[model samples]
Target chain A: MRDAVRVWVLPAGAGPDELARYRAVLDPAERARAARLAADGLRDRFTVAHGALRVPGGRATGASPAALTWRRGRYGKPALTGPWRGLHTSLSYSGDLVAVALSEGRPVGVDIQHVVPGGDPVSASARFFHPREARHVAAGCDQAVRARRFVRLWARKEAAVKAAGGRLWPNLGMPVDRADVVECADPAGRHRLADVVAPQGCAVAVALAGQEPYAVECRTDLGDFR
Target chain B: MLEHDVPTRDQVVERLTVLLTRMLRPDAPVTEQTQLMDELGLSSSLGLELLLALEDELEIQIDVEELDEDRMATLADLADYITANSTAR
Candidate 1:
């Protein structure tokens, strides 16, 4: 079978009952990690529900969650450690939404941002955005125009650096202004990255360094799994 | 070969002042002695952005190593370096 990258987008309404169904599949340590996150209030039922959705697709082998260890590089970027060498995965959460990215042979990163009209575009652009990007935002002629452009740029750059598998500083050398749709050639190989727009003025970007065209599956029904 | 006059130091400084004022939103004049970080609070990311802008605007390749804090102390200093280096090329 050909290895394929899968992206899963969980809807805003996913809840606890949906998460309970996957408990049986999780190894003891994975369960423990979920419990810890829940206790700390860093996550709740919805977080666990989406995390469960990612479990089977992670391609994790063995009986223990410890088998799914991750190694951290210099800048604290994390990667899976094991026989799953080239496989890449990442998960992101905002408000009630959760998104995950998986690829067979290259690092993958994904980001989603909800557009807030009349937001502070300049400050956001100044902190995480490229200089030319800030100029683009500033030239938008009005508030709504600037806010939309700012979120698009923010999502694109964050996803790109995450897939680059290093510190954000190293990727600074790459031209983010020309990054609208990039096909980056790195030491590992070439990879494609593109942005996706979600309904309700949301911006999403996904980065994949694999052979196939990227596909995104948006799931609004976690109850079906239950 | 046709001769093209190199950009004068004053011209380079003038362009850089506008770029810096627009990007950094600083009120004071950008001078040779004005420290970029101390005066304008140009973070590392912004410094990289300035380098990229200089590269694209002037069509010059800036060595990353040359942009250390000491060399990039002021707007005029950066403009001077970019003009000198690009003209030499």
Candidate 2:
């Protein structure tokens, strides 16, 4: 059977009661990381995101949420430590949205960005993006137009980096052809990219390390598990 | 490739401090001795982000051959590499 790339999406604005419930699922280190966040909102989001990570990870690895050992990848992406080492996963969030991606044998990455009407993708493109990408983003006639383009590229690039086990800075200078269905910068490692179906004002993308068609599921409501 | 004149230690540090403070940790104090891995919490990804920011600010391309975990151990070390490799401007 072709392993499907499973995904989970949750809101970052769960109330204190909901937050407390999800917080129970996180391990000691994750709990401590949540505590280190200066803001309650940030803490709440971290709890939800990490808590979501545990659900599928637990199901696949047969490890308890608290007992699942997470080892950091070269770029700080987390992986299952020990015998369940073949599994791959990635997580990301922006504003009130959070996302998690999982695959059995291939590395996977997911990114989500909350799009704003007046945000300046043009300036951002000029500043840090590759010259080729910067021009493409800048080609948009207005702020609203460019903002959409910005989130699309940002989400795609971030997903690519996570899939490759690399970092954003080095790849920022590398051009990503938005026109291509799947942009693979590394010849040795092939990848596939697709945009996720999300709510209004949100741009999301998932990148997987194989060319095989993946069964993509957009789960907007995971609060029932809590 | 031709050799380029290295920047003064103080110049590199000054530029790096500005870039780091703005990019990575505006709240935290940055200095030559600030540990990139421990203190600043620069994972390989964040380190690459900082290098890109540095490259953009300094208008110089960092050679892949010059970068390694050992050489980028601290803010000072990164500054030294930037100074040594950047072209004269």
Positional deviation of residue A20's Cα in model 1 after best superposition, in angstroms: 3.0
Best TM-score goes to which candidate?
Answer: 2
Identify the candidate with maximal DockQ. 2
Each model's TM-score?
A: 0.56, 0.74
Residues A94-173, model 1: lDDT tens digits: 44455667666667877666566545677546544557777788889888888778767666655776676544433433
Off by over 4 Å in 1: A1-4, A22-42, A58-67, A169-177, A180-191, A210-226, B1-89
Per-residue accuracy of model 1 over B4-71 as CA lDDT, tens digit each: 44556675677667667777676566666666755565544356556555544554454442334445
Model 1 TM-score, all chains together? 0.56
Computed on C-alpha atoms, the DockQ of candidate 2 is 0.13
Candidate 2: where is the Cα deviation over 4 Å? Answer: A116-120, A126-132, A173-175, A178-187, B1-89
Question: How well is each residue in B26-80 modelled by candidate 2, as lDDT tens digits?
Answer: 3457878876654554544345456556665555665544455556768888777
